[model samples]
Target: MRVVIALGGNALLRRGQLMSYENQLANIRTACDRLAPVAAEHELVIGHGNGPQVGLLALEGAAYTDVPAYPLDVLDAETQGMIGYLIELELGNRMPFDRPLATLLTMIEVDPRDPAFENPTKPIGPVYSQEDADQLAAEKNWVFKADGDQQRRVVPSPKPIQVFQLRQIRWLLEQGSIVICAGGGGIPTYYDEDHKLCGVEAVIDKDLASGLLAKEIGADLYVMATDADAAFVGWGTPEQKAIARAHPDTLMEQHRDEFAAGSMLPKVEAACQFARATGRRAGIGSLDGITDLVSGTGGTLISTEFDGVEYRD
Candidate 1:
């Protein structure tokens, strides 16, 4: 089956792990250990998150003070190339030499008038002391929001409208190449009043963008491989329960308010959008469960085919 897998940022660098080349390389090797088999069996398109990677680049740029730091769109592309090369290298090592692979720097369009621009909620870069955050905000005219006891830089997260590289991606897949693109929501861009295409100072939700990619590419299956194994109802509580299968609309109606807005909610919503849009299966689960997820035996499968919500044992 044609499959599109959206690898969460955690798949490359888990939380609490030091962001180092060695660590990320090791993780990609591990992820490829799981993904190579899938690529061998089916047409595969990969999308990945770059929150931590992009933030790290921004932080490093901030320290230089030699020139104005590159914009978020540029940093997104950098992470795509940086992370894509690692994944492509590692995944290629396990596959047959004849199988080809390619990574594209995708561009996604967003509405210039999107309200998200007025409200910057997506956090990026390193956390800082309240004083430092305030100082930076004053000096740079940047926004900051409290992240626990510390503060973090915030950027607008607008919806992804169009993927500019769809034809290229489709052509690559037609050639039987394993493709990776749409990193960090495809380098957010939009046309200005002057009708000139310009990169926006924003981030796009990777899950949402990946869902759009899945739909536009006519994928039979779209899965978000996240840190969590499954989408749970009453997560973190004694009544918590794992959902094994669900009809997108039914699942939302029954437990829409249960998901955490910043995390599981987006994944669920994205999965539902794809499932409803195409009447195909979309899954959310841990990266380790990718094999079973493809087979519909693991992860929480969301689709119009299910009767309703079904729980796991």
Candidate 2:
């Protein structure tokens, strides 16, 4: 089976955790442990979120006066390599010695006219108190959005238009290599007026980009692993509950208002888009339920029909 797994930010650096190599390494090792069985049995392409990683880099860059802070695109590329290297090493440690592994620095194309450039809405960096976020926003001229009780910096999160080097990714899978690409939504890039490719100061929604990649690669299944076990309604209240399964339209109709736009909304939206677009199943759940997710349980499952049966070997 071909599966595309999009890791949540927690997979790398959990919320409020220190962004230290030791912390990140511990997290990546656990992630690879969960992924080893899947990689052993299936053709896998992994896409991971780097919000915290990139945000931490941005903070580091600000401490220097030697050169302009690297653009978002450059930072995206740097994180891809940085995170992918950890995944490659850690995942390799658990699998066959000769099993192929490749970390491709994917570059996705975005429309130069994308409205996201004008209104930044994607949240990155660490979550902060409202006061801290507001102060940082005022000082840096950055946009801030409420993330639950906390706030985070928001940047333009444009949709991915094209995934470059897809053929190479496919080829690597064919060669039995475990591929990790499209970290931080494939390093957002665009075509300038001169018709030359250039990087942009924007971020792409990793779930959306991962869904697009799953479709482009003709994956049988797509999974968005999150810190939460399921997409819940009335979250944190007595009425909070998990939606075990629902058609994309059903989910939209019943629970659209319940999801957080910055957090769960885009993820559910992406899962719905992938299921509707490809007539396949997509799941959203905690990373612990990885196998159940692919098997059509342990999360909110999206499909053409609520009763559709999942076929597995």
Candidate 3:
């Protein structure tokens, strides 16, 4: 089956861990190990996030006094290439030497009139204390939002309207190649007032983009691999319970608050979109449980048909 797996940013750089190059490589290697067997048997396309990486790059650039810091669009492209390289390299090492891998610098188009631009809700970069966040906001003219107990940078994340070069991706998959594309949400581009396509100063949700990509590419299943083990309701309290499998509509109606904005929200919404769009199942779960997720042995499977959730005793 053709599957599109969207890797969360936390998968590569765990929260609170040092964002060192070696650490990222180690994480990617571990993720690749989980993915290698799947790649060996099925048509796979990978999409990943770059929130921490891009934010780190921006901070580094801001420290320099000479050149202006690069925009988020450029940083998105850079992270796409960077993460795609690491993924392909590590994934290839785990698989047979003959399995070919390719990473396309994919572009996605968004509407210029998207309301997200008016209100920046997507968080990027590192976390900061309220004092530090306020200072940075004052110095850099940047927007800040409260993330749990701390503040982080927020940028407008417009909805992805169309994906370019999708045919090429399909062609590559047909040729038995594992393709990694749409990193950091496909470069966040749109046509300008002058009628020329151009990159924007915005980020696109990678999970949402991956879902759209899955639908456009006619994937049989969509898998959103995140740091969480599975989609849960009452996530952190005493009544918390794991949702092993369920119809997407049921989950949406019954467990609305379970999906957090910055974390599992997009993944669940994306899975539901794909499930409703094609009447197929989409899985959201831990990267470590990927193989089992695909086999229906693990993860929260979002389906279109009504069914009770398979819960663990």
Candidate 4:
């Protein structure tokens, strides 16, 4: 089967773990081990989140006063190359030498007038004290928002309108290559006043962008491999329940308000969009269960084929 898997940030960097190269290597090795079986059996297209990686690069850049910190788009590309290289290296080691792997630096166009520009909600970079936040905000003309007791730099999260490298990605996939592209939502770009293309100072929602990728590429299954094993209702409470399967419309109508805005909601929304658009199944689950997810036996499968929402024990 042709599959497109979107790897969540947690899959690359676990919570509370030091963001060290060794830790990242360890995590990706695990991810590759799980992916090897799928790669052996199916056509795979991989997209991954690069929030933590990009943030780390931004922090490192800020440390050097010699040059202005690289823009978020540049950092986005860097992380795509950096992370993609690691994934290719690791995944390739596990696969047959004849099977090829390629990482494409994807560019996705966003509307310049997207309201997300007016409201910068996506946080990037390291946390800062209020005083430091204010100083940096003034110095860089950047926005800040509270993240727990600390603060973080906020950037507009624009919706991806067009994935510019779709043809290239498809060509690579057709050549039987495991292609990793669209990290951190394809280096958000747009046309300038002169109709010249340029990068934007924004982030694109990775899940949504990946969904678009899957739909455009005619994927049979699009699985979002994340930290969560499944999409749950009544999360964090005794009544919390895992959703085994759900029709996209039914999921939205029956349990839309249950998902958190910045977390599960996007995953569900992306899955629903792909399911509704392509009439195929989309999954959200832990990366470890990817093989089962592909077989439609694991994860929270969203599709028009499902009757309604069903809970797991």
Most accurate candidate by lDDT: 1
Off by over 4 Å in 3: 308-310
How high is each candidate's TM-score?
0.95, 0.94, 0.97, 0.95
For model 3, residues 1-313, the per-residue Cα lDDT tens digits are: 9999999887799887788999999999889989988888889999998888988988998999799999889989999999999998899898888889999998999998999999998888889999999999999988999999999999999999999979999999989999999998889999888989998888899999999999999999899998788988877898888888888787788787777887788888999889989999899999999999888788889887748566644
Candidate number of the best TM-score:
3
- Name the lDDT of candidate 3: 0.90
lDDT of 2 at 2: 98
Candidate 1 off by > 4 Å: 127-139, 146-150
- What tens digits encode model 2's per-residue C-alpha lDDT throughout 1-313? 9999999999998878988999999999999988888888899999999898888888788668698788889889999999999999999999999998999999999997998888889888888988888888787787888787888888899999999989999999999999999998989988888999999998899999999999999999999998988778778897778878778887788789989888899999999999999998888898888887877758778888665322221
Q: How many residue pairs clash in model 4? A: 0
Worst 10 residues of 3 by lDDT: 304-313
Compared with the true structure, model 1 gives a TM-score of 0.95
In terms of lDDT, model 4 sits at 0.91
Between candidates 2 and 3, the TM-score winner: 3
Task: Say which prediction, candidate 3 or candidate 4, comes out ahead on TM-score.
Answer: 3
Which pairs of residues collide in model 2?
Answer: none
For model 2, the local distance difference test gives 0.89
How does residue 184 of candidate 4 score in lDDT?
84
lDDT of 1: 0.92
